[model samples]
Target chain A: MITKSIMIVGVGGQGTLLTSRILGGIMQEAGYDVKLSEVHGMAQRGGSVVTFVRYGEMVAEPIVEEGQADVLIAFERLEALRYAHFLKKDGVLIVNDWRIDPITVVTGAAEYPENIIDELGRKHKVYAIDAMKEALALGNSKTFNVIVLGAAAKHMDFAKEDWLKVIEKTVPSKTVEINQKAFLVGYES
Target chain B: MAEKKIMLGNEAIARGAYEAGVKVSAAYPGTPSTEISESIVKYDEVYAEWSPNEKVAMEVAIGASISGVRAMASMKHVGVNVASDPLYTASYTGVGRGLVLVAADDPGLYSSQNEQDTRCVARAAQVPVLEPSDSQEAKDFMKFAFEMSEKYDTPVIVRTTTRLSHSQGMVVLEERQEVPDKPYERNIGKFVMMPGMAKGRHVYVEKRMEAMSEDGGGFFVNRAEYRDTSIGFITSGIPYQYVREVFPEASVLKLGMVNPLPRKMIEEFASKVDKLYIFEELEPVIEEQVKSWGIEAAGKEIFTRQGEYSANMLRRILLSEEVTEAQAAQVPARPPILCPGCPHRSVFSVLKKLKIHAAGDIGCYTLGAVAPLSVIDTTICMGASISSLHGMEMAKGKEYVKNWVAVIGDSTFMHTGVNSLMNTVYNQGTGTVIIVDNSTTGMTGHQDHAATGKTLKGKTVPAISIYHFCKAIGIEHVVEVDAFDLPLLEKVIQEETERDEVSVIITKAPCVLLKGNHFPDVCVPVPEKCKKCGACLKPGCPALTKKEDGSIAIDATMCNGCGLCMQLCPFDAIAKEPK
Candidate 1:
């Protein structure tokens, strides 16, 4: 019974919740017990949001403790740096090369750190993809989260068909083709 | 055979209520608990509603219960404070039919003003409480809670935390059991809580508690798992999962029924184990009780009572493991902010320009106290904005509060602010009150309220106009202004403060996040007309950001073309771009 914990980190309204749902659905289809947990309400107002998905033969708690996540799927670079500790020593780090300035940085109270990818690359197995650019290339920036999820899917054990099926079921009917292309670009990158 | 499907804890509770044949359900939307009633409304058999406040919701549920039908009320932990008065009395005058109250506790203050333990309130009110650890238990315990309510003839409480309420897990679905409603009998002694009848009901409540304690051990919900007897853990709710995850080999007494302890089972379990440790979160309700039975146990001493508990916390406590701190680069704090075109942003901008000291209330408007537009001076609780402003004016003369105004939301104004506003009129106090009417409960995900002119089931109703309501409450001067109209809002604020009598300013604007409510145009920066002056960034809209070269650029994806930044720009650099 091998249990794996994945932490999805990003700013609110970045489709992190939807990504977790698709991921959880894929895991459930793979015949593993899965638990997905997230914070709602006040935290969704342009704040840093993190969701945890744990799956195995049996998962006890939905939370991922510090230094326990096997994979860190970050939708933003700064968010990737912020929640890096949750990853295990040999964990795979998949980060989108995008930056959303926090309120402090916008208000001149603090500075957004430089060289985030380089800093994380030195310690962990880092995969940096320009997911937002790829989604824009696909003619929709709203599909950015799916691109990140597609990049993350390459590291997981689930079949590519399972991921596509889950995506088709989760997303709306009209945008399925474009999202599938976004996922493929993310997976190949 | 029942199929297992993935469901959130809140959704599972709603399913549980539906399966239990609940005829009526009422709730005031709050985080974590809001989705329960929302999910229940999908079932056509149940008559569900979103009451104006928790107190009203509780009374509505109680009314249904007394009419010989199963009913339930749900709210967040803070909302229990508003509904406590009726809850306490309902305990004395037991339910005619099964009744359950769901209080979703926020353990880590994830989306709440305070982290409170609902178990303590349940004990104070002498109500039996059942705490569920996962989605399966969330549904199972809800059904069990209603049974316990009917069996003991009392209102049962099902306590959940943010983790359990928001987490998704597999639940085994069950068909609805159509339980027939009991016959309604007009027995005043049992239903009424008069002083004379209350004394007799109090005795009955004590007897009921005694019977429950004695027989609770035989119930299926309370169980003792004896694995390795060397060290035993007595835990319940979400904490039980953490303990099991951390110490899989240790024996545990997982008590689903939190209150009305099963004395016999506890004593037997204690004698079997060499060392007993009570693992619970937030409060030591169980630990204190076990200790009062002359049984020594380790609890709050090992675990702090401040925040939530986790497997890592338990591992650190028992194994003496040092938590590995991340040495990552410093990240800027990402505090929650008002959306790009939030109506509250305009109100806060005007209050900041006027240099007025504003007492804030709960909801999305509380974000006004944050940076750039820091106008709020104090925020104690819901509806405290108006009353606190009146108190300040009375304490430090009318001249001191000439620059002070109380800001509240439309949902909060109806929640309890109406009483506070009437207090100002009755006491003859001179203070300005501003209701930021965004049409819906913005903070809890835009649930319809009394003033929203819509029912929980999406039925249209007559919307209560806030301006007219204020005038009817004896306020002489009531003015309504568009929140985005900066000059008009500023002018109204200045005029109201100069006048002697009490006045109300209703800022009317729908929340930008509401569906189909966004302005079609997006604001863009005209590069040639730009100056490096930082005036446009004063309102702190997340969409407006400074480029690497120091000129401001609006993120077209984020901007809603509210023209607020354009109004602040002296160089006339910001303009609305055609879609």
Candidate 2:
């Protein structure tokens, strides 16, 4: 089997790293070698955070070079645009259709960019979803990361059973039913 | 059947470490990472304690690890910076038992002074780095890191980001391993990092890394994906999955152990793909390494070197040239700031109003540097404020320094401010040091400190007061004033500054979020007797605002009234009405 790289990006407190954990569980349960790394900058003051996960046989480095990401799962739209260079030519880009403006952009020190998809059109196959909205529909507005994860899982080779099992293993039993349902919605959507 | 629990990423790390039979855990409390030790505290087996600072915490962990019991040390990214001196040597000295140091990074200045990357430290130490994306991974990685530590006889770093540390997810519980009670036979040369001993340890570290690369192949931590391989991605942590999400058909390589990376596995994967993209966060450590290996790759450049990434970020870089204006318009921005009714606000408010050039210290009180309050002038380290104020006083005569008060939090004062306080008294510097005692370490979710009179385990400890502490330090004028009493506080501050010798004002107030406290003062609006002189605006209270008619109105809903603005107003227009 070949190795594949994935990148997850979002603002701090948006569960970016939890998405990494869920994926890590799925990959581990699927019996694949996995290495996950995350970088958090100024996370306390509501800054952005990113997580990098590599899986498959014989994965070497912890980071993916520009234009080589097999998949890019973003919790925020603008964040998706921010790290687009990591996507390969045919890379799959699944982004939550949400934008969390940075402090500079919000305070008008910098102009908020207009279109994320247009900028990403040159090198990736982008699919945007209102994952946060779907998560809110699942009863918790914060579960947007899970919803996005579910959508990303749909195109992955890891079996649905393995994913579900890993999800069960990763999450508590109390919220298992809902998270599973959320995952299904994300997958089947 | 065992029950699974939904836990935060930090809790999972704690549980993971516990399951791995971690015997000793130490950390200095900081956001995005504080909960690791706190969660470990709930377990019966682990000896967990919040050390005085990150440096002490690292030393304690090192001492524990040397005892042959699996030990763990954790801190935020900056905390790791403080502990770097020990961390660098610890890697060379190696570990007797498993040692896992967790560096929880804060990207985007979430709660940090700057966005310094921790990956560089991982490489600098030449230790294996494990990055976990989610809660379960955080837990599993914790166990894997410990196992790797033992196998390699070196400390392993489990690097977690803010999202991974604070966000909650489901985690299946498992039986924990029993920890060995006895210490390992000590070899002074191996444990000690003196020049001669360190050289031998370094050679051993290199040998371990070689064995790990050879014997560690096909391990569960490294995996490969074969798909449409026109381009393949190599990434770790949470970003690995995002790469897969964005490029479903591309082959990908995911590496869990980042440092001393599994080179054999990476080379095999690189041969299949026509082009490679390295996906990681902050700096291009991996990308630079790949290039050094003579493998041309791309990452961080097209993807931007700063901030976090998402599918949209990847798509924008690789798919589209730019984002539509409308798409950008749809994004929402929420930035964290000092929570409303923060106790430190009043102290900074008085300082800013009095035009005092204050040297600020760490803690939640550091938010005083932000706009609207803009009270703090300089923030160097945890307890630098007091010493800085002393220097400023000595540098720029006492008269100029009188208007400059050093502001520090209660937890900070307990940490290192006491020495500076004694120095001020010893040298007879007539500087006014204002202790914003919020009754807790407010920056890190109100953790208990010595001043809080509570230990980590909820037991009562001796409570020390800045008031009495200053008095004992030979400051004859030690005054404890209500920080919310703005008028009285201003007068007291002025009086303290004019004093010939060293003095202090303990602006004491419980944090608004503190339980079981009644601070009934609410902002009262006066529409008639008001002149819009903007005196109340000078304090920049969030509750007070100018109405459309140019009269200052108070949003009772938003105000605790604290009556701070009332004191600033000369017209007696704003008064606290009985709630």
Q: Rate the local accuracy (lDDT) of all candidates.
A: 0.91, 0.77
Q: Where's the lowest-lDDT run of ten residues in candidate 1 chain B?
A: B322-331
Docking verdict class for candidate 2: incorrect
> RMSD of model 2, in Å?
8.6
- Compare the candidates by TM-score and give the number of the best one: 1
DockQ of all predictions against the true structure, Cα-based:
0.77, 0.10
Model 1: residue B404 alpha-carbon error in angstroms: 0.9
**B293-382 in candidate 1: lDDT tens per residue?**
999789998888888889989888898888676654567889889999898998899899889989999898888887988998888878
Clashing pairs in 1: none
Each model's interface RMSD (Å)?
A: 1.4, 8.6
Task: State the lDDT of candidate 2 residue by residue for B43-161, as single tens digits.
Answer: 98888887767877888988888887899999999889879889988888888789999998876455677677788888887778888866778899899998888878888889987
The per-residue C-alpha lDDT of model 2 at residue B76 equals 90
C-alpha RMSD by candidate, in order: 1.2, 8.6
* Leading candidate by DockQ: 1
